[model samples]
Target: MKKILLVGAVLAASFGPTSVLAEEDALLVEARKVATSLPPKLIAALQDEIQKSGAEAAIPVCKDMAPKMAGEISQQTGWKVKRVSLKARNDARAIPDAWEKAALEDFDKRAAAGEPPAKLEKGEKIGNEYRFVKALPVQPLCLGCHGPIDQLSPGIKAALSQNYPNDRATGYSEGQIRGVISVRKSL
Candidate 1:
């Protein structure tokens, strides 16, 4: 009876941590799904806009339409979604909160240490909320506006100046992390 009780206690103790880990794993999966669902759509929209008009014309797709798409995703998924960066383009919208700032800083360090920027992501539970952030690596297409200021086309520069006078999101090369798609949900 003593041996049987000890075995049972050990099993219970092991299962307790396993179950919590499983729960965290589940949250991470869901958060990843929610976090990844936006960028492709935004990219497609930007491509279409650029093709129809020009890179200068496509500025609104990122500046305006991306947030609207994120809003729609938030409504559909019950998770709040937004973009943030260490060097924000839209001063009003792209500033990272404390947690997001920490995650972005960590991502940059990891990327600098030779981790692929595309694979840099972090997800965990904080208080009653599950939060996730996925790095948005700068693509060749993003360089029209997000590349070095000296290299930007005159039209693109004018548009950015007119729209976001205080923009700081520039000087990024391909594969560099531009920002993160941050998502959170109350658990």
Candidate 2:
């Protein structure tokens, strides 16, 4: 009976991880669908207003709106949400997570060579253990903040400086890895 119990325990343990991965993957897919659809439309609406009024007036609104959207997604789905990008051309840099950083670098290389925008990589260790990472390329609208320094408006740059003082999240072109959705299951 003890041996039978031990075998059952082992089998449950093996199945547990698989179940967790499936759940995590499902939650991640949902969260991505929500996040990706929201940001660009918000940014475009804000950009139209900015064109009429100017960046100074629009920056605060956009800045506030960004995290509010992230917060909304978090509230709706109990998963953490975030944004990350490649190091700026000028700053001494550290990515939000290293595994993500490496994946972005590879994604950027592939994109630069005229490839597709999204990628999935496996077994990339972040923090404590390996995880599956999905990198999505930032679109043209993202260039206003994440693009080259010369292209940024003074107000937007000021906003970026104030919001993310250690930011290395600029100088990204369209089709480059702006960041990723990194999800792992809680054991």
Candidate 3:
């Protein structure tokens, strides 16, 4: 009887946190699936636009499609999904709220500590909502517009100037953190 009780206690103790972790992991997985679908499609469209109409044309696709894509995904998934940055080009969407600011800083630290940017994510339950943030590293392709200001082509530079005059989103290197996909779902 003593051994049976001990074994039962051990099993319960072992499964407690694992059960919670597993549930949270499932939430992260679902959020990831929702986020992962949107960006590549937008990136593909941006790339094709750049290939045909030049890099200048791709900017509008990003500016316009990003929000539309977010809205569509939010509607379909019942999650409030958006992109944000520490240094924002679009002030409206890129501004991080209190929780998001903390998550972004944490992600930056984790990424600097040798974690893969693609694998870095933060998810938590706060009050009546669940929040998650996934890192979006600066890809080699992103450097065309997002890299150093001096490296930008004349046309691209002029377009950025006209479109986002107060842009603070330049001067990034490849593999660096650019922004995040933030999802908030109400419980």
Candidate 4:
């Protein structure tokens, strides 16, 4: 009886996921791949720029090239892709709508509760679109530009002031959630 019960429990656990859950998980996987593909390239480009011309030179790459790359990704994926944060440097692009705001808040809580930001994500169907967001944690490379305001180098500060006079995307530590890659697909 004990052996039979154990086997039954194993079988049930193996097959327990509902079809809807399975589909959602698959959707999340697709969403994550599209979302994650850009950052690494952007980081590598920024690294090259910094190494060749210094950290200040990388500012334009992030401010201009990053958006262009994101736009290309959006064109390829046929889904709206963007970056947003609680403290957005670019007011036009970083502002989160109501749903995105809620998701970011939830992500913060989960990360606070020991969830790895790299593995953090949220997705849901809203009206006619399926929305997804993946947390972007502050990395070591990010600190040079997005670190504590007072701690920034003079050149970096001047560059930021000239480029983004009203920037608010600072005061972040490594491993902290800096922003999110937000994606949406019409259903």
Candidate 5:
């Protein structure tokens, strides 16, 4: 009877943590799905706009349409979604909160240590919320506006200046982390 009771206690203790881990894992998976749903659509829209007009014309897709799309995703998924960066282009929108800042810093360190920027992501439960952030690696398509400021086309520079006078989101190379798609849901 004593041995059976001890075994039962151990099993219960182990299953307690296992269940919590499983719950967190499920939250992470759902958060990942919500976070990932926006980028491809934004990229496609930007590509279409760039092709229809020019890189200069595509600026509105990122500056304006991306936020609207994120809003829609938030409504659909019950997760608040936004993009953030260490070097924010639009200070009003892209500034990272304390938690996001820590994750972004960690992502940059990991990327610098040779981890693939695209694969750098963080997800966990914080208080009453589950939060996730997926690194947004700079792509070739992002180069026209996000590359070296000196290399930006005159038209692109003018548009950026007019739209975001204090933009700091430049000087990024392909594969570098440009920002993150951050999502959080209240639990």
Candidate 6:
């Protein structure tokens, strides 16, 4: 009977809240590090300069590098990261993946209200399917690429039209949700 009780206690302890807390701490630490540091200041400064010079210069960089940046972050952290720009239109391909679409919307609302967004959990249907989501707020520097369309220069508009004919990521306000950082840790 004592042996049986000891085995039960061991099993319970192994699966206790303490283990879960440790996992959460580890994930949070990793997430914060990559989110805060991966996109260094120089990249942001360059984007700002491009925007100030004219939209044309900045849009190209945003269009070309957004996805690549996400990929790079994923490579650095071993966790998948995705950027989901908000869109006014609901076209098939623009928002093809339901999870990404939903996550973006949710993040937008929280960001607009000035509430800090939380990390998406497993089983949450955020951007692609069971995506774990964290919001990426538009920094002041990000205004160059993501700010209101009306403020964009003719050159920028032209560049945007040339690069992404179906681009729907414009007309954003400061502190808006520009994208998300997603991760799916292995079991």
Give the per-residue lDDT digits (tens) of candidate 4, residues 113-187: 988988888888677778899888999999999999898999999888887788998899988899899998886
Candidate 2 differs from the real structure by a C-alpha RMSD in angstroms, to one decimal, of: 6.1
Q: Candidate 5 at 99: error in angstroms?
A: 1.0
Please give, for residues 1-187, the per-residue lDDT of candidate 6 as tens digits.
Answer: 9999999999899789878767666766665565555446436746675658754555545545655776777787676665444562213323425665676776666656767643432234223323355566666666655678888767666766676677677777766666665555443
In candidate 5, the residue pairs with backbone N, CA or C atoms under 3 Å apart (3 or more residues apart, or in different chains) clash, namely: none
Give the per-residue lDDT digits (tens) of candidate 5, residues 1-187. Answer: 9999999999999789888998899999999999999999999999999999989989989989999999999998899999999999999989999999999999999999999998999998999999999999999999999999999999999989998889998899998999999999999
**What is candidate 6's CA lDDT for residue 120?**
33
Candidate 4 matches the true fold with a TM-score of: 0.86
Q: Per-residue lDDT of 4-95 in model 1, one digit per residue for the tens?
A: 99999999987898888899999999999998999999999988998899998898899889999999999999999999999999988899
lDDT of 2 at 186: 32
lDDT of 6 at 104: 75
lDDT values of the candidates?
Answer: 0.93, 0.63, 0.87, 0.88, 0.95, 0.59
The candidates, ranked best first by lDDT, are 5, 1, 4, 3, 2, 6
- lDDT (10s digit) by residue, model 3, range 1-187: 9999999999999799888778778887888888787879988998899899989879988899889999999999998999998888988779888888887888889888888888777888777778888888988889888999999999989998898888999999987788899998887
Off by over 4 Å in 3: 1-22
Q: Which residue segments of model 2 deviate by more than 4 Å?
A: 1-28, 34-37, 88-94, 118-136, 157-167, 181-187
Give the Cα error of residue 159 in candidate 6, in Å.
0.6
Q: Relative to the unseen true structure, what is the C-alpha lDDT of residue 132 in candidate 1, on a scale of 0 to 100?
A: 96
By lDDT, the better pick of 1 and 6 is 1
Q: Give, for candidate 1, the lowest lDDT window spanning 10 residues.
A: 13-22
Instruction: Give the Å error, residue 138, model 2.
Output: 4.0
TM-score of each: 0.92, 0.60, 0.87, 0.86, 0.93, 0.66
- Scored by lDDT, model 3 comes in at 0.87
lDDT of 1: 0.93
| TM-score-sorted candidate list, best first | 5, 1, 3, 4, 6, 2
